[model samples]
Target: METVNVAELVERLGSDEDAVRKMAVFKLQGNIGDPSFADIFIAEGGLVRLRYLTLHASGNTLAYSLTSFSRLLDVDKGWECVDQELVERIVELIVTHPLVNILRGAMSILVSIVSHPYTGNRTSQINNFGFRALKPAIAIYPQFLEMLVSRLSSADHALCANALQLINSLMRDSITHDPEAEWPKFIQKLQDLGVIRAVYVLMQDSALQDLAHPLLEFQSLTKVLLRKWRDIPVNQEKPEHRRALKGIYLASNPEKNPDEATENGDDTRRSRRHHPEKWRRLGFETESPAGEFYEVGFLGMMDLADYVRSHGDEFQNMLLEHSTKPSRQRCPIARASLAVTSILYEHFEVEKSDMDDTKTYLISESRAGFDKLFQPLLLHWTRLHVAGLQAFFRLWKATAAEEEDLDKLIELVRILIESVVGGAARIKDVQDVEEELADFEYHRLRGLQMELLELTYEDAWGQHLRQVREELHHEALQFVKEQRIRSLLQGSWFALDSHSRSEPGPVQKSTATYQYAQLSHNRRYLHFGQFDLMGDRPPELDTLPEKISNVSVNPDHSSTATLKTAPRQPTTKITIHGYAPSTATGHGKGHSHARSGSRTTQKEVVLLTLRPSSHSIASEWLDGLLMLLNQQPITAETSKLIDLVSNYGLKIRLLNVRFDDATFAGEAPQVPARDGLDEDYYYDVFGGA
Candidate 1:
């Protein structure tokens, strides 16, 4: 590559000849990736010239200028040169651009600027700048989001992908940087802009099937954003109000001891510390440890649930049409559509006493519309299958008042449980247990089983369906036990049967124990001993603290001396770090408790390492241990359900997929042929240089 002079390119960018200016901008675009070139270009005023062209130039010159800015924004401090005025200009260009190439270039610049890794104090400030700049365009242009949604159906694949990516980036940046205040407003804006309706139409368009991956991401992120918005503090009160309440309570109750009040306050603070983690496990985002938020409430009547209900006929028809199609097993758009619909229905709630007859009729009509979907949803082996089952239970709980309705719902539940049980039995017989444990369908069946068990345990359902509930519970437990045995035989981690024991006991036989390490049934202790082939002696067990700090997997084993002589299998070294009760007595040296006349138990940080047979088994053990540490439910069925929902329902799988370079790179601008045209024709067709 020839070393081009940055000063010359900057001069040519302001040339009177249109072709000369266009070639210079294209050359600048190709070279902006170089740090040296970028620094020199900025110093030589090349960036200022490019920004000027974006406003003054048109067609190929304008598109290439934006593309160059997109690349330059990746360099250090490149965003600083683009001020609020320039950002507003870019947003304006995006709204008014006629050609697909121009739109692609403008959107790519926005994505680069929004998704840049701004660190330290500048992160929020820069994010706020970008959002503030777009506010005017979004406010003035009512069709901004709809215009982007329309691009989802464009023939240009690159343009379609870039449009979806830009939307995803914008939403992600809003929630991630400022979830509490700005995200809720952003979501409301998107709703008001009719983006949700546009999404519904795009999802139904069969011509856009190739854009399924990004579509799923957009759908899933929308659902997540709504849930996050709901999780925000509804009561936006100041901290002073809480302090005032505390003072009032203390002043009213003079008999209350100050020490007792302090202790109670401490307990409340401790519980608040764990509140965020608990809600996060249930798929809700939490901003602070205080976790002040309401449950998913009615976000007025225009929420997603209301939208689906209002369009019940069309929504049901879409479901029926997709479910009947004979296509590939994996339908990203269809699966995502059902998942979103399921979430909407699940979040649907109404106050019966406050509801008028119109509201009641709408609810009943929506329920009936969903009732038709249960047959096809149950037949499919997708993640939506479990979601559909859960939606059915929730809807039934909300509206099923008559005994005939209850009877029909109970029979449907019975059939679903039977189907899940039969599926599990066949899987156990035909498939490898290890593979089945990792399969999504296997987890889906497990989620169905758990949902059925939960239904059986409900007080209202238990009273009406006593005999059937009993049978379902018994079958579910039997299936669980069989799975536990199979998982152990395959050398994978299996949750111990807690019903067999009242308290912590010896390690369960169903748990796979390596030669020198074992985890107790209650998962409260880890036992380690010398390697022994015979059942001769017991291993020394140490109590694990309630909170485990960390669990890590290390693949390198050559550093350990014990494994030096052992044959190297596909091994993985697992390390755990946490606090454990110290074994030292009060009489021992360095015992501060002895001097203080109090024999308080001291805790010490301990590290434990174990070598598992294979990487997959190590990962299974790691997941189980992390779950135990996080205080999440550890039953086999619950684990499977959490995995299924996190992966498919929440579309967490999108975290791994990203837009590559090709998605952002715009097609080269086409130049007109100059066979018989005069030089004036060039200046007339294109804008003046």
Candidate 2:
């Protein structure tokens, strides 16, 4: 208990008698919780003794030693005392130790260590701390993953939570840090090891109702993986790529390859340009390729509907179960279940038979499941509310051909519109309603209503729905305008200032500085100024364009632009050629002060160029500027820009593109792959060679 006795207690750790050694470890575990005691113990070489005990001790002694280390790791700079050798010993115990307490203790220590704040690449950090021990441990020792998966079923809530957290943390750190190199291997390993299945099974455990955060996190991370994995390219030699190539070859040489053509004659053929339309009809985005579809499979199957069907009862119960009071814990599981159900209903081949018996059954079950959440979601909006609405729309669309289901679908649509509009009206703040309308959920809701109007144009309910749709559409446009203004007003941009006289010189020949550029609150004047340590100075160039001509993105011309920083990303340049009033010349950090009574005006072209840190940021700026200009009649170029912005926004939101500044220092930005068939696979998929 005393600081003076800490040394004596640590010295007993090496006693010849097992009882004395165990007693010393037990005492150290209790005392190590105190920072001063931990400092004293480390000063007494207590960590070396603890490390030795972890490797050689057994039963309660090993558990006590791990507990002591866990306590020590809790203190400031305690992780600094841990070395790779000690981490290996702890990992060894994790894989081989039979005692539950020892395993729990070791897991806790590793979690504390891995989660310690660090700079630089996460992979480098893991390697430095010997956290890579688990990688090989799982690779060589088959039972390690199984052991972790088994613990997910443990009745001990802490153990269950820790096991889930440990696995999630490892996968996230490794895959996110080096997604291209690590993602496929790590995800495949998790799938092969049944880790994914274990998480699903854990969700079914009614006893561990309190483990919601970890459960929700694991499910969300899995969703991200599924989305990201679709973008990653598989080997060009894979059967999917080979088959696509052979089809193209046969289509081109139908006379010479008559046998091959006849073998595939039943297939409906389309040109490469028409592939996008075909995929869209199959319920895929135009951006997604047929090969990419084949790349996304769970548990080695292309379709997850079968798995959902197998777990149909459990999922139904998860969604349908309700508590008298709203349960925060229930919301996540319910949302996760809804997300899984959506996977089945959201995307399906339109040409396929309308509703097979299997689909009919799942729809019936999922509809009942959704019924329980509709009222609760309306009362209190959780993410489940969004998923519920989206899933219900997909369900409504699925039954489009069934005359018997038409009335029921219309009734549900009316109820949904009443609930949403009623909820919007309750929030008296006009801005709050606009904010709600801006969200993806409201967007989906509005879209569904519009679709319903098309299906029931002559129906009496159609008139009310059309009015609601128009109101929502108006609110959404207002929200977009507001967002553009807010974004323009809030942030300072890094603009490229080239000294070269030529137009848009290489970025290397230019310098970048923080520039305060924004449109006036009244939207009358465009303001520009330089930012200094103190704050923004007066405008250097304040001019509203007489004829705003062009806003576009061009590739960076800097030779030093590497994949780590730029990666073929473009920069946004706004070429505003217009006249300016004499007032545009003002006293500022970078411009001369105007003389009193100087009212001269001149016609001049002002070019503003922005070097965004990433493609998403560039797209954001371009979108804002284009919306601000609102050029007359919306040129074709401007329409294309709008479409580009929409696609980029969806991908950015899906990837949740928030990265630490340090993460971009020397690594490729781990974003989803670019749209279309991968350029790398061009030859393999369609080349004449």
Residue pairs whose backbone atoms clash in candidate 1: none
Q: Model 1, stretches more than 4 Å misplaced?
A: 116-128, 140-142, 177-182, 192-194, 197-220, 229-689
Candidate 2 has its poorest 10 consecutive residues by lDDT at 373-382
RMSD score of candidate 2 (Å): 27.5
Best by TM-score: 2
lDDT of 1 by residue, 1-689 (tens): 99898899999998999999999998988999888889898899777778889778888998899888887776644666566666767777777777988898888877776666432125334543444446666777756776776776677877877787778777777777763556767766666665554554545444443455455556556546545544444332555334432332233222232212334665754644343333222112333212322333222112323333444443344333433333222122222222333343343221111123333433455534222211211111223333343433333434432333543444443444345323442113222322332232533544565565445344433453355434444444344334433332233222212232223222122232334544444444443433313244434334212222122212123234333223335333555533342344322112112234233443322234445554445434544554434433233444554444333421221223333334356875566797886666422211111
Q: Against the unseen true structure, what C-alpha lDDT does each candidate score?
A: 0.48, 0.49
List TM-scores for all candidates, in order: 0.39, 0.41
Error of 2 at 510 (Å): 99
Tens-digit per-residue lDDT, 1-689, candidate 2: 35458778878998999999999998888888888878778888888888889778998998999888887776643554466666667667777776778888888777765555432223334454423545544555556666777788777787888788777767666666653465667666666776755665555455433555566566556545544544445344577554543442222322332222333444524333333333222122343434333434321122222323344443333333422213222222222222333332223221223223333433454533322211211212223233334444444434442334534543443434344434543223333433443342534654556445444432533464355445444444445556655665554455444432235421122233444466556554445543432244434334311111222212232223221254234333334333332344432211121234332543233434455555445444445665666622122333354445543443333234333444345876666776684556422211111
